[model samples]
Target: MKSILLSVIIIIIISSSCVNKNNSVQDKEEIIAVLNQQQKDWSNNDLESFMDGYWKSDSLYFYSGKKLKSGWENTLNSYLKNYPDKSYSGTLKFTIAKISAITPDSYFVMGEYNLTREVGNATGTFMIIFKRIDGEWKIIADSSC
Candidate 1:
């Protein structure tokens, strides 16, 4: 009887651990989905929607080239000024190279982006740090290469 009970408890523990692992994977997938939508919105030239992926608070930070930008609105305005419209935004494609959930509420992702259009094309790499707030993942700090 003792042996049987111990086996059952061990099995239960193993099953519970598996469930937790699966849940973690699902959470990571949700974050990835948010990032994917962000890319699509940018490609569609919807700066407003693209901005949705970012943390709306003043704590948001972004670095592009050699300049460091802060605030959500400032980032959006800069994007609009640089991209202007669909012609400049072009069709964007992102290939995610690495994505890791650093903690229950934090993630780090690295990806390469390409813009396609009649005029020209630009390609670069991006690294983003996301934090979960109010059950939603938002980019807290992002940098481009």
Candidate 2:
């Protein structure tokens, strides 16, 4: 009886570990999809749709260059001010460098962004913290350089 119980416990632990690993892969894929969608939206000049990947909360944070922006509205305002039209927004592209699980509910992602615009071309690197909230993966914090 004791050996049977021990074997069952070990099996349960292994199964749980496997499940967690699978969940991490699924979460990473979902987050990447969100990033891809953002790029598509930006290329289409749909600012509102691009912002959908971000956390829609007052506590959301974004840092670009030397500027620190707080809240979803502020971030949206900054994007609108910086890219007022398609000529400024341009065609966006992303190259993911890394995506790692920070926690079961959070992930850290680093990527490079390029914008082909009529005004000029722009390229930057960004690191983002994505958190699973309300059953959705949303970017909680972002830093672009």
Candidate 3:
């Protein structure tokens, strides 16, 4: 009887492990797909669509250069101010270096971004935190240089 119970426990653990592994892979793929969509949105010069990747809340955080801002609207306004138009915004390309899970519902991504434009080209590195909220993954925090 004890041997049977032990076997059952082992089988449960193994099954649980497999489920967690599959879930983790699915989470990563979803996050990567979101990033890819953001790249496409930017390339299309659709800032509104690009901003969909970020958390649409006042608690959202963004830090870059000497400025640190909280709130999604503030971040969007900054992007508009800096970029203004396609020539200023350019074509965005992201090279993701790593994406690590912080929790089942959260992740951190480190990557490099390049903007090719008529004005000039700019390259920078960034780390962003994404959290699953309302069954959707949204960037909650970002730090870029």
Candidate 4:
């Protein structure tokens, strides 16, 4: 009985270690790719495509400058309201200053965002939380600072 219990403990530890390692590597690559795609889609001024990088469920949430926006539709509507035209959309440019994995399947990303438009250049900093869900990386929760 003691030997069986010991074996189970060893197995559990090894399994957890492997899971953490795999999740760490995958989370890093997935988050970077998702962020990169966001910039690409924004630069193209494709709102629909840009939103694809985000978690599309009803639970998806975002906060900007103290304003909390919940759900995918709300976020999309806000974007459309703000950037109605291509000129307003401008070209999305981002510099990822830092990205840290907070857990095996979660990350905290901080970056600077800029838009070059006919009117002027608008810039801001953003901090977003990304989570891996069902083997895909999604922005489960986000807040722009």
CA RMSD of all predictions: 2.0, 1.1, 0.9, 3.4
Cα lDDT of model 2 by residue, 38-127, tens digit:
999999999999999999999999999798899999999999999999999999999999999998999999999999999999999999
lDDT of 4 by residue, 28-126 (tens): 777888888988888777888889878998898899878988998889888888888778888888788888888767788888999998767799998
Candidate with better TM-score, 2 vs 3: 3
lDDT of 3 by residue, 1-145 (tens): 9999999999999999999899889998999999999999887888889999999999999999878999999999988888888998889999999999999999999999999988999999999999999999999999999
Candidate 3 Cα RMSD (Å) = 0.9
Order of candidates by TM-score, top first? 3, 2, 1, 4
The residue-level lDDT of candidate 3 at 121 comes to 95
TM-score of each: 0.88, 0.95, 0.96, 0.80
Each candidate: how many clashes? 0, 0, 0, 0
lDDT of 3 at 49: 90
For candidate 4, report its TM-score.
Answer: 0.80
Question: After superposition, which runs of candidate 4 have C-alpha atoms over 4 Å from their true positions?
Answer: 1-23
Which residue window of length 10 is worst by lDDT in model 4?
21-30
Better of 1 and 3 by lDDT: 3
Off by over 4 Å in 1: 1-13
**CA displacement after TM-score superposition, residue 53 of candidate 3 (Å):** 0.4
Pairs of residues at least 3 apart in sequence or in different chains that clash in candidate 4 = none
**Pairs in steric clash, model 1:** none
Q: Tell me how candidate 4 scores on lDDT.
A: 0.85
